[model samples]
Every structure is written in structure tokens, then in C-alpha cells.
Target chain A: QKEVEQDPGPLSVPEGAIVSLNCTYSNSAFQYFMWYRQYSRKGPELLMYTYSSGNKEDGRFTAQVDKSSKYISLFIRDSQPSDSATYLCAMSRGDSNYQLIWGAGTKLIIKP
Target chain B: DTAVSQTPKYLVTQMGNDKSIKCEQNLGHDTMYWYKQDSKKFLKIMFSYNNKELIINETVPNRFSPKSPDKAHLNLHINSLELGDSAVYFCASSWGQGGADTQYFGPGTRLTVL
Candidate 1:
């Protein structure tokens, strides 16, 4: 089984909608969780990151991790057209920062 | 300055051809990695190097080798590439092996094997 699993979503939402993207993992050892945004033809850009299980807020994005359930989420408050891209959830265990288990990205399309 | 960069934004080659993708990071990071993104967009780690030392090899085929001349550069060379080898490849680098260390990625190279 893949360590990380995410729905490959073409999640479409109207402007200003609250968008929630999620991922689940089987490894209980994962302590670092991250969310990355990848636009067309570009690399994955780190959007929100958190250590262990907690909440970290930055601008309109909030990253929540539940270590107990091995689940992570990325929430967008004011979704915009520019926010339309692929969202990928990545996590790593202990000191293996060089190895990140990535999920199949979820494509989000925000309507104008 | 670009933190991470890759050459040949797009490559089209025939099957059985050998090609190498070059990567460089100016972030002063000691660790570098190579990841493959398939058509389904599943990003998988192929190899990693720290200080020019091979640290992690994810059972990638011997035909696929990663060369690191230094901490700042990591290159992937695939020999006799197959049609399945056509995918987007990404290079990334980070400072340390910490839970909080942020990894920066380079613009991916889209490889098309005919």
C-alpha cells in the first residue's frame, strides 16, 4: 500500500469558497506534514507546513495534522482563480527529511 | 537567484536512448533528491544524496543512476530508456534531516520517450 493516499480531485469551487483538501497515511512514524501547490509546468511550491499534529495558519491557508489518525488537511479560506492548481500532501518520518512520501495530487479548479 | 533549477525544461527522445537530466541548487543545501512524477501525477522518490554521498536508493533500476559531483548538484541518467520512463522529473534540496526543514524543488523536466 502507498504510505500516503489522497483523492486525485478536480475539485471545482466558485470564488470565495472554502476549499478543503485531505490525505491519509498508514505510517504512524510520520511527524512532519506539508502541503504543496503546483501550477501548470512548474514545480511543487510549499504552501503550508506543520510539525507533528497541530495547526499552523498562514494567510488564507491552514494546515491541520492529526497524528493519531495519520490524516492531514489543507484548508483555503478565500479560494481564488490563481489558487487553481494541484495540491499535494507530503509527510516524512523522524530524521528522514530527504525522503518524503507523497500522495497523488488533487487538482483544484476555482471558478471565476 | 533561483533556489533550485533544472536544464532542458522539455525533452523528447526515442526508446532505448540514453539521457541525463541535470539539476543544481543554489540554496546552499547539503542534501539533494530526484523524484519522478508519472502521468497520474504521483511523485515518487528515486534517489537521494547528502554531501555527494549516496544516502538513499529506492530500488531504482541499475540502468537509472544518480550522479552527484557535489552537494549542490544531483543528476539522473537513464540508460536505454523505455516508454514507461516518459515522465516529469523533479530535483529538490534541503538543509538538514529535520522534521521542519523545508525542501525546495526545481521546475520539473518533462521527458517524452517515443
Candidate 2:
């Protein structure tokens, strides 16, 4: 099994709807969970990250991690058309620091 | 200023050819990484450098090589590029160390090997 597993979703949602993107990992050693947003022709940019199992919120985005279940999620509330992009989930065993394991990414489309 | 920058934003060349993609970070970061995103949108780590020293080298082909001349720069050189090498290559840097350190990524180099 892949270290990180994320559904490569082209999930379409209407503007203002809540969007939830999720990832599951087989490695319990992953301590850092990150969500990245990537637009067309652009590189993935880190949106938010959390080192613990609780949820971290920033404006319209929230990142949740369940270390016991090895699951992570990114929630976008009041989603806008500008939220249309690929969302990538990444994790690292803090020990290596830069050795990040990234998922296949989920493509989200927020329609007007 | 752009935190991370990569040269030749778009690279297109024939198979078996040689090419290089350069990356530079103005964030004064000590760690840098090279990641490849394929057409399927799967991002995989190729190599990483910490202060101009090799740190993480993934299970990539030998034709691909990474060089870090300094802490602020990491260049990816493909000796004999194959069609499979066509993908979007991204350069990223972190402030200090560990995944907790937010990584800033470059705009990405889209390489198309025909």
C-alpha cells in the first residue's frame, strides 16, 4: 500500500458549499500533516499544517488530523470559485524534516 | 519577492536529450527539495538537500541527478530524458527543518519530453 492515500477527486461543488478533502496514511510515524493548494500550471502551495491530532482553523480553511486513525482532512467552509484547485496532502516523520510524503491530490471545482 | 524561483518555467525537448532545471530560494532556507508531479497529479519526492548536502534521494532513475551548489540553490539535471520524464517539476524550501516548517514552492517547471 502507498504510504499516503488520497482520492484523486475531481469533486465538483457549488460556491458557498462546504468542501472536505481527506487523506489516509499507513504510516503511524507521520507527525506533520499539511494541505497544499495548487492551481493550474502552478506549484502546490502550503495552505495550512498541523503537527497534532486536533483541528487547526484559519479563516475559511480548517485542517484536521487523527493520529490514532492515521487520517487527515482539510475543510473549506463558504467555499468560493477561487477555491477551485488541486488539494494535496503531505506528511513527514518530523525526524527527517524535509522528507515529505505527498498524496496523489484531489481536484476540487467550486462552481458559480 | 518570490520566495522560491525556478528557471525555464516551460521545458520541451526530445527523448535521450540532456537538460537542467535550476531552482533558487530567497527565503534563506537551509533545506530544499525536488518533487515531480506527473500527468496523473501524483506528487513524488525525487531528492532533497540540506545546506548543499544530499539528504533524501528517492528511488528514481540514475539518469536523474540533483546538485545543490549552496544552501539557497538546488538544480535538477536529467542526463538522458525519457518520455516518462515529462512532468511538472517543483522546487521547495523550508525555513529550518522538519515538516512543521512551512515549505514555499516555486512556480514549477513543466517539462515535456517528446
TM-score of chain A, every prediction, order shown:
0.96, 0.97
Candidate 2 reaches a DockQ of 0.71
DockQ by candidate, in order = 0.63, 0.71
Q: For residue A79, what is the lDDT in candidate 2?
A: 96
Report how far residue A81 has shifted in candidate 1, in Å: 0.3
Model 1, A19-104: lDDT tens digits are: 99999999998888999999988999889888888999999999999888888999999999999999999888847534777899
Candidate 2 stretches greater than 4 Å from native: none
Report residue B1 deviation for candidate 1 (angstroms): 1.4
Q: lDDT for model 2, please.
A: 0.91
Query: Given candidate 2, what's the lDDT at residue B102?
Result: 79
**Model 1, span B13-98: residue lDDT tens:** 99999999999999899888889999888888888888998888897889899999988999999999999889999999988754
How far out, in Å, is residue A15 in model 2?
0.9
Off by over 4 Å in 1: A96-98, B98-100
lDDT of 2 by residue, B24-105 (tens): 9998999999999899999888888889988888899999999998999999999988999999999999875666677899
Q: What do the candidate models score in CA lDDT, each in turn?
A: 0.90, 0.91
Q: Give TM-scores for every candidate, taking all chains together and pairing residue i with residue i.
A: 0.96, 0.96
